[model samples]
Target: MSTFFHIHHDGDAHGPEAQRIHTELIEPVMRDLEERGRLDRFYVLNFSGPRPFVRLIVEPRESHGSNLAREVLASLRSRARELDFLGEHDIQPQGKVA
Candidate 1:
């Protein structure tokens, strides 16, 4: 299974704010997970369609399962909330289900 973070962006705000979040918030955590062999891949993508934003996808290692992935994703979501990237909500769960 995979974990996905759907990030909301404010175009009016400076671009680096989002960039900083990726560099400072997301990357290190992802790298740590990767180092532990928990994460297979993680990426942030920007789309040009309606309501532009970045999506973070975490694919777990072959030895890792969806439960662990969800736990890590949950931690990331909480961190995003703490960082004010998400309000009370805004971090949505998407894609294929169990």
Candidate 2:
């Protein structure tokens, strides 16, 4: 199973802004976590709808336990706030999945 975190943004999913967010914001954080060996695998999905969103599917390192997902989510949220992006988006834990 894996845990998913949905980062709902109030903007176009396929816009340059979304690409910037992924490259400048999300990627850096995910890369850092990966370097720290905190996660087994992670994926980012861009979705367009009434409320466009970026979904993060994370598989935590078994040695790190389930809390790793929550930790990563918190880190992303914190980084977003630091980068002044949280005001336009929200990160929510979508729970576990098979």
Candidate 3:
């Protein structure tokens, strides 16, 4: 199944910690998904405001297995918490509509 995952940050998206998390945690999992041919679509969007952050778009590959969502979420969540982002930030999946 495919879903939209959002990570809203209240801090600096280009900060040192954010960069580390992306490099160490998020990127690896994304690369895995790509290698598995289970990554359908991806994007990085930015919004400017008093609180600025980036939104990432990930679409599961059409022929993916049942566990693709779980795998992706697990990888992102682990690093988000490590960066102290679970509270001020948010990570949730938007179910794909049939």
Candidate 4:
């Protein structure tokens, strides 16, 4: 099954360490997804505020064997910890059949 995964986190999405994690951990996942033809687009978004908001959107090419939600959860979870994100995160999954 294919999936479109949306991840939400409270952190400094643009900070140096956050950027490192984004490039290293998160980008790799998106790479694998693209290679498998399961990735339409993957990207991180940031919000401006005292309480920062960060998110990654995963758009899959097909809805078969989709584990984007799980994968994204892991990425966000791990990176946030390593980066010591000032805020916690809430991961949300959204899917649509194509």
Candidate 5:
């Protein structure tokens, strides 16, 4: 399965806050997953709309599956909260995609 996190922002896509989340939180986790061979594919999608946002998609290897995605999502939630970039309502899951 594939899981995703939608990160909403009020500022521009290239703003410091967005960059920080990408660099400080997302990249490191992605690198670790890649190094461990637990990742299938990942995508960072940016959108500009009434509520500008970024979508982080993580598809783990079948051997790891949704469990790995769940763990990654949890870790990201915690880190985002700690960094004050995300609040409880900031992230919304779009459910599992096969």
Candidate 6:
């Protein structure tokens, strides 16, 4: 099984706080996961019109699964929460892909 973390950015995505989180929290974990072959995929989506928002999709390798990814994601979320940039987040189970 795979695991996906859905992150929603409530504030300005390009703002200083967001940048800090990206640089210090997100990017480092991403690099570590990539080097370990534990990163399945990552994507960013934007919603248009009023209340524009951005969404982050992160999938971790099936072998490592949610157990491992959750720890890293939780850290990232904690930082974001402290910065007040996080809207919400959720983890969903992803079936293995061929």
Q: Pick the candidate with the highest TM-score.
A: 2
| Model 3 residue 43 distance off true place after TM-score fit, in angstroms | 1.5
lDDT at 91, model 6 = 20
Q: What is the TM-score (0 to 1) of candidate 6?
A: 0.51
lDDT per residue as tens, model 6, 55-81: 445667877764665655566666666
Which window of ten consecutive residues has the lowest lDDT sum in model 1? 88-97
For 38-71, candidate 4 gives per-residue lDDT tens digits of 6688767765566554456666666634565676
List the global CA lDDT of all models: 0.66, 0.78, 0.63, 0.58, 0.78, 0.55
TM-score: model 2 vs. ground truth: 0.86
TM-score of each: 0.71, 0.86, 0.61, 0.56, 0.81, 0.51
lDDT of 3 by residue, 1-98 (tens): 44666665566667754555456656777887898788876665554466555556677777664667766777678766676655423665557422
**If ranked by TM-score, best first, what sequence of candidates would result?**
2, 5, 1, 3, 4, 6
Q: Report, for all candidates in order, the number of backbone clashes.
A: 0, 0, 0, 7, 0, 0
lDDT of 1 by residue, 1-98 (tens): 66776666565223775676577667877888888888888778764445556677788877776565566656667777676665535455566434
- The local lDDT score (0 to 100) that residue 51 gets in candidate 2 is 88
Candidate 2 segments exceeding 4 Å error = 96-98
Question: Could you tell me which residue pairs clash in candidate 2?
Answer: none
Prediction RMSDs, each to the true structure: 2.9, 2.7, 3.7, 4.7, 2.4, 5.2
The CA lDDT at 62 in model 6 is 79
Pitting candidate 1 against candidate 5, the one with the higher lDDT is 5
What TM value does model 4 have?
0.56
Q: Is candidate 3 or candidate 4 better by TM-score?
A: 3
Better of 5 and 6 by lDDT: 5
Collision pairs in model 1: none
